[model samples]
Target: MNEPEAVDDLIADLPEWATTEEIADTMRVKPQTVLKWNKEYGLKTVAVGTRVRRYRKKDFREFLLRSAEATD
Candidate 1:
Protein backbone atom coordinates (compact mmCIF):
# COMPACT_ATOMS: atom_id res chain seq x y z
CA MET A 1 0.00 0.00 0.00
CA ASN A 2 1.11 3.52 -0.65
CA GLU A 3 2.25 5.51 2.30
CA PRO A 4 -0.20 8.12 3.49
CA GLU A 5 0.20 11.59 2.07
CA ALA A 6 0.94 13.05 5.46
CA VAL A 7 3.75 10.58 5.91
CA ASP A 8 5.15 11.36 2.49
CA ASP A 9 5.05 15.03 3.31
CA LEU A 10 6.67 14.43 6.65
CA ILE A 11 9.49 12.47 5.02
CA ALA A 12 10.02 15.04 2.30
CA ASP A 13 9.95 17.90 4.75
CA LEU A 14 12.02 15.90 7.23
CA PRO A 15 10.49 17.60 10.20
CA GLU A 16 11.86 17.15 13.71
CA TRP A 17 8.48 15.72 14.68
CA ALA A 18 5.98 13.35 13.08
CA THR A 19 2.25 13.45 13.33
CA THR A 20 0.18 10.52 14.61
CA GLU A 21 -0.98 9.91 11.07
CA GLU A 22 2.59 9.78 9.85
CA ILE A 23 3.64 7.23 12.42
CA ALA A 24 0.49 5.19 11.84
CA ASP A 25 1.19 5.13 8.13
CA THR A 26 4.74 3.94 8.74
CA MET A 27 3.38 1.11 10.89
CA ARG A 28 0.56 0.47 8.40
CA VAL A 29 -1.97 0.86 11.14
CA LYS A 30 -4.80 3.25 11.94
CA PRO A 31 -4.31 6.53 13.74
CA GLN A 32 -6.44 5.27 16.61
CA THR A 33 -4.14 2.30 17.03
CA VAL A 34 -1.17 4.61 17.19
CA LEU A 35 -2.86 6.66 19.89
CA LYS A 36 -3.60 3.50 21.83
CA TRP A 37 -0.01 2.43 21.60
CA ASN A 38 1.06 5.85 22.76
CA LYS A 39 -1.19 5.59 25.78
CA GLU A 40 -0.60 1.94 26.69
CA TYR A 41 3.03 1.66 25.77
CA GLY A 42 5.66 4.33 26.18
CA LEU A 43 5.38 5.82 22.73
CA LYS A 44 6.66 9.19 23.81
CA THR A 45 5.28 12.37 22.30
CA VAL A 46 5.91 16.07 22.53
CA ALA A 47 3.43 18.86 22.01
CA VAL A 48 4.20 21.45 19.43
CA GLY A 49 1.16 23.48 20.41
CA THR A 50 -1.65 23.27 22.90
CA ARG A 51 -3.17 20.28 21.13
CA VAL A 52 -0.89 19.27 18.29
CA ARG A 53 1.13 16.18 19.13
CA ARG A 54 4.24 14.85 17.50
CA TYR A 55 6.81 12.09 17.86
CA ARG A 56 10.52 12.52 17.57
CA LYS A 57 12.22 10.41 14.90
CA LYS A 58 14.87 9.12 17.30
CA ASP A 59 12.41 8.25 20.04
CA PHE A 60 10.05 6.56 17.63
CA ARG A 61 12.80 4.48 16.12
CA GLU A 62 13.89 3.45 19.56
CA PHE A 63 10.33 2.52 20.42
CA LEU A 64 10.06 0.40 17.29
CA LEU A 65 13.31 -1.36 18.09
CA ARG A 66 12.32 -1.99 21.67
CA SER A 67 8.93 -3.29 20.62
CA ALA A 68 10.53 -5.64 18.10
CA GLU A 69 12.85 -6.95 20.74
CA ALA A 70 9.91 -7.55 23.04
CA THR A 71 8.19 -9.67 20.39
CA ASP A 72 11.32 -11.61 19.63
Candidate 2:
Protein backbone atom coordinates (compact mmCIF):
# COMPACT_ATOMS: atom_id res chain seq x y z
CA MET A 1 0.00 0.00 0.00
CA ASN A 2 1.16 3.50 -0.66
CA GLU A 3 1.95 5.53 2.43
CA PRO A 4 -0.42 8.33 3.25
CA GLU A 5 1.07 11.81 3.28
CA ALA A 6 0.38 14.38 5.92
CA VAL A 7 -1.83 17.23 4.85
CA ASP A 8 -2.23 20.73 6.16
CA ASP A 9 -5.57 21.74 7.65
CA LEU A 10 -6.77 24.63 5.52
CA ILE A 11 -9.46 25.67 7.94
CA ALA A 12 -7.06 25.39 10.83
CA ASP A 13 -4.75 27.76 9.00
CA LEU A 14 -7.54 30.31 9.12
CA PRO A 15 -7.83 32.39 12.25
CA GLU A 16 -9.94 30.93 15.06
CA TRP A 17 -10.94 34.47 15.85
CA ALA A 18 -11.17 37.66 13.79
CA THR A 19 -10.25 41.29 14.37
CA THR A 20 -12.68 44.21 13.94
CA GLU A 21 -11.01 45.17 10.68
CA GLU A 22 -11.23 41.65 9.36
CA ILE A 23 -14.90 41.39 10.21
CA ALA A 24 -15.58 44.74 8.63
CA ASP A 25 -13.84 43.71 5.45
CA THR A 26 -15.85 40.49 5.34
CA MET A 27 -19.04 42.47 5.92
CA ARG A 28 -18.09 45.06 3.28
CA VAL A 29 -18.31 47.79 5.87
CA LYS A 30 -15.99 50.14 7.70
CA PRO A 31 -14.24 49.02 10.91
CA GLN A 32 -16.18 51.59 12.86
CA THR A 33 -19.38 49.94 11.65
CA VAL A 34 -18.27 46.75 13.27
CA LEU A 35 -17.69 48.61 16.49
CA LYS A 36 -21.14 50.15 16.22
CA TRP A 37 -22.74 46.75 15.80
CA ASN A 38 -20.77 45.46 18.73
CA LYS A 39 -22.48 48.00 20.89
CA GLU A 40 -25.99 48.16 19.40
CA TYR A 41 -26.51 44.45 18.73
CA GLY A 42 -24.58 43.18 21.70
CA LEU A 43 -22.13 41.38 19.46
CA LYS A 44 -19.60 39.76 21.72
CA THR A 45 -15.84 40.17 21.99
CA VAL A 46 -13.02 38.76 24.07
CA ALA A 47 -10.52 41.08 25.69
CA VAL A 48 -7.04 39.76 25.05
CA GLY A 49 -5.36 42.03 27.56
CA THR A 50 -6.69 45.24 28.92
CA ARG A 51 -6.45 46.84 25.47
CA VAL A 52 -6.94 44.41 22.58
CA ARG A 53 -10.18 42.64 21.68
CA ARG A 54 -11.17 39.80 19.37
CA TYR A 55 -14.36 38.28 18.07
CA ARG A 56 -14.88 34.55 17.77
CA LYS A 57 -15.14 33.28 14.20
CA LYS A 58 -18.36 31.44 15.03
CA ASP A 59 -19.96 34.36 16.80
CA PHE A 60 -19.14 36.84 14.05
CA ARG A 61 -20.41 34.46 11.39
CA GLU A 62 -23.67 34.09 13.29
CA PHE A 63 -23.90 37.83 13.63
CA LEU A 64 -23.58 38.17 9.87
CA LEU A 65 -26.29 35.63 9.29
CA ARG A 66 -28.70 37.21 11.77
CA SER A 67 -28.06 40.69 10.46
CA ALA A 68 -28.65 39.55 6.88
CA GLU A 69 -31.95 37.98 7.88
CA ALA A 70 -33.01 41.14 9.65
CA THR A 71 -32.59 43.16 6.48
CA ASP A 72 -34.94 40.84 4.61
Candidate 3:
Protein backbone atom coordinates (compact mmCIF):
# COMPACT_ATOMS: atom_id res chain seq x y z
CA MET A 1 0.00 0.00 0.00
CA ASN A 2 0.95 3.57 -0.45
CA GLU A 3 1.96 5.78 2.42
CA PRO A 4 -1.47 7.26 2.89
CA GLU A 5 -3.17 3.90 2.66
CA ALA A 6 -0.76 2.44 5.17
CA VAL A 7 -1.40 5.31 7.51
CA ASP A 8 -5.13 4.83 7.20
CA ASP A 9 -4.81 1.14 7.91
CA LEU A 10 -2.70 1.85 10.96
CA ILE A 11 -5.25 4.33 12.15
CA ALA A 12 -7.98 1.78 11.68
CA ASP A 13 -6.04 -0.81 13.66
CA LEU A 14 -5.12 1.58 16.41
CA PRO A 15 -7.51 2.10 19.26
CA GLU A 16 -9.39 5.33 18.81
CA TRP A 17 -11.34 7.08 21.52
CA ALA A 18 -14.50 7.02 19.45
CA THR A 19 -18.17 6.80 20.10
CA THR A 20 -20.06 3.51 20.07
CA GLU A 21 -21.30 4.35 16.61
CA GLU A 22 -17.78 4.86 15.33
CA ILE A 23 -16.54 1.66 16.97
CA ALA A 24 -19.43 -0.28 15.52
CA ASP A 25 -18.69 1.07 12.07
CA THR A 26 -15.01 0.18 12.37
CA MET A 27 -15.57 -3.29 13.85
CA ARG A 28 -18.51 -4.09 11.60
CA VAL A 29 -20.62 -4.68 14.67
CA LYS A 30 -23.74 -3.03 16.00
CA PRO A 31 -23.82 -0.12 18.41
CA GLN A 32 -25.95 -2.19 20.77
CA THR A 33 -23.21 -4.78 20.87
CA VAL A 34 -20.75 -2.22 22.09
CA LEU A 35 -23.08 -1.15 24.83
CA LYS A 36 -23.68 -4.75 25.79
CA TRP A 37 -19.98 -5.43 25.99
CA ASN A 38 -19.52 -2.48 28.26
CA LYS A 39 -22.31 -3.64 30.54
CA GLU A 40 -21.23 -7.25 30.59
CA TYR A 41 -17.46 -6.85 30.71
CA GLY A 42 -17.02 -3.65 32.63
CA LEU A 43 -14.97 -2.39 29.76
CA LYS A 44 -13.13 0.83 30.36
CA THR A 45 -14.48 3.92 28.67
CA VAL A 46 -14.68 7.64 29.04
CA ALA A 47 -17.24 10.37 28.67
CA VAL A 48 -16.07 12.96 26.21
CA GLY A 49 -18.91 15.36 26.90
CA THR A 50 -22.60 15.41 27.31
CA ARG A 51 -23.93 12.15 25.85
CA VAL A 52 -20.60 11.31 24.30
CA ARG A 53 -18.85 8.05 25.19
CA ARG A 54 -15.52 6.87 23.92
CA TYR A 55 -13.00 4.02 24.23
CA ARG A 56 -9.29 4.51 24.68
CA LYS A 57 -6.68 3.07 22.31
CA LYS A 58 -5.00 1.03 25.05
CA ASP A 59 -8.29 -0.33 26.30
CA PHE A 60 -9.30 -1.46 22.85
CA ARG A 61 -5.97 -3.13 22.22
CA GLU A 62 -6.08 -4.93 25.51
CA PHE A 63 -9.61 -6.10 24.86
CA LEU A 64 -8.67 -7.45 21.47
CA LEU A 65 -5.66 -9.23 22.89
CA ARG A 66 -7.72 -10.75 25.66
CA SER A 67 -10.28 -12.02 23.21
CA ALA A 68 -7.60 -13.49 21.01
CA GLU A 69 -6.09 -15.29 23.97
CA ALA A 70 -9.44 -16.78 24.86
CA THR A 71 -9.84 -18.14 21.37
CA ASP A 72 -6.36 -19.56 21.36
Best by lDDT: 1
User: On a 0 to 100 scale, what is the lDDT of residue 25 in model 1?
Assistant: 80
Q: Which consecutive 10 residues in model 2 have the weakest lDDT in total?
A: 1-10
- What candidate 3 gets wrong by more than 4 Å, as runs, is 1-15, 48-50
RMSD of each: 6.4, 9.8, 6.1
Of candidates 2 and 1, the better by TM-score: 1
Q: Can you give the TM-score per candidate against the true fold?
A: 0.71, 0.67, 0.66
- Write down the RMSD of candidate 1 (Cα, Å): 6.4
**TM value for model 3:** 0.66
| Location of the lowest summed lDDT over 10 successive residues in candidate 1 | 1-10
Evaluated at residue 35, the lDDT of candidate 1 is: 86
Model 3: per-residue Cα lDDT over 1-72, one tens digit each: 124444355447545677788767777889998888777866577877767888876575566555545556
Residues 1-72, candidate 2: write the lDDT tens digits. Answer: 111121112122336687887777665789889888988987888888876779987676556556646666
Model 1 C-alpha lDDT per residue in residues 1-72, reported as the tens digit of each score? 223454444445435688999888877899999888889988999877777889887677667656656666
Q: What lDDT does candidate 2 reach at residue 44?
A: 87
Q: Rank the candidates by TM-score, best first.
A: 1, 2, 3
